[model samples]
Target: MIACSAELYCAADLLTRASLGELDVDIVAIVSDKPAAGELAAQHGVPFRLVDGGLAGDSRAEQEAAFAAVLDELEPDLVVLARYMRILPEAITVRWNGRMINIHHSFLPAFAGAKPYHRAHQRGVKLIGATAHYVTAELDAGPIIAQGITPVSHRDEVEDLVRKGRDVERTTLANAVRLHLEHRVLVWDNRTCVFA
Candidate 1:
């Protein structure tokens, strides 16, 4: 399962790269509340589903349950959270466990959660980075699997950082996914022992 929100850039990047046989697994479906996400799945020749937290606009628990049911039905070996923009409850995370991962825009242990790039820029940080890791209940605090970074000068604006962050996010996430696919990552004590 591949979950996403409004924009499909990250999802498209991952699906495109995955389709090239970099890994043995297949992208069975893309789930989202955004229609454009489903359109992206269609363009990429993958199945799509809209998970609206049920038709009644129910509670958080209901929404989570609906998503969990969808995943249960899909039975995918792995789930990639590509700019998914939703915080899942513990129930689903426990079920997916090591099988789930996400790409965070910051190097992590810094600027975690949403709008990381914007925050990093606001702090006038010189170097920005991206981190891909297993999706633990703690937001973006999972075991680090792979990372990518680039320098940002003072002259560079927030938009510039956001642009550069996108590159880092893409490569970092791809590397992490590749490592996971190849079974090259071992987790312990909330850290990763990545085998080359």
Candidate 2:
């Protein structure tokens, strides 16, 4: 299953790959709080679930609980957070453990949270990268499964970094998902041993 926010960039790529029989997994459902995501899932013929507990008086805890319930109902073998902007609650993270994975916009251990491409551009970094890792409670510090980087020059602006970073993110996330599904990734001490 894929849980995402407004942008379905990763999800769209995964769906395309799956439709072409490139991905050897079944996408059970696409769950999100946005109708835009639902529309995307509909276009791909995947089941869509709208579980937004943040409607008016609902608390954050309620939203988390609703999301957890969606997972329980689906009971997916793997959960991929394809740009799911919200930070998952601790209970959900612990319950899912190694079964959940996420794609961060940076190479991780640096600019681990939001707007990583912007940070990379501001620092005049020569390389912008993406990280695919397990979703632990400690933000983006989970065991890294896959990463890809692209070279950038001083002339590259924030938009340029974002464009390059998206490409890396898509491929890296796909590789990570493939590795995990093939049972070729082992985690120890917050790191990964990928036999690839």
Which predicted model would earn the best TM-score? 2
lDDT value for model 1: 0.86
Span of 10 residues, lowest total lDDT, candidate 1: 51-60
Candidate 1 lDDT at 72 equals 84
For model 2, the local distance difference test gives 0.90
**CA deviation > 4 Å runs, candidate 2:** 53-57
**lDDT, candidate 2, 25-73, per-residue tens:** 9999998877689889999999998766564567778878889999989
Q: Clashing residue pairs in candidate 2, if any?
A: none
lDDT of 1 by residue, 1-196 (tens): 7898885777888888878876566899999866678779988899998876534576767777767888989899999988888899887887788989898889888999888878998899999998888988888888899999999999999899989988888888888888999999999989999999
Please give each candidate's TM-score: 0.94, 0.97
Candidate 2 positional error at 102, Å: 0.2
Clash count per candidate? 0, 0
Cα lDDT listed for each candidate: 0.86, 0.90
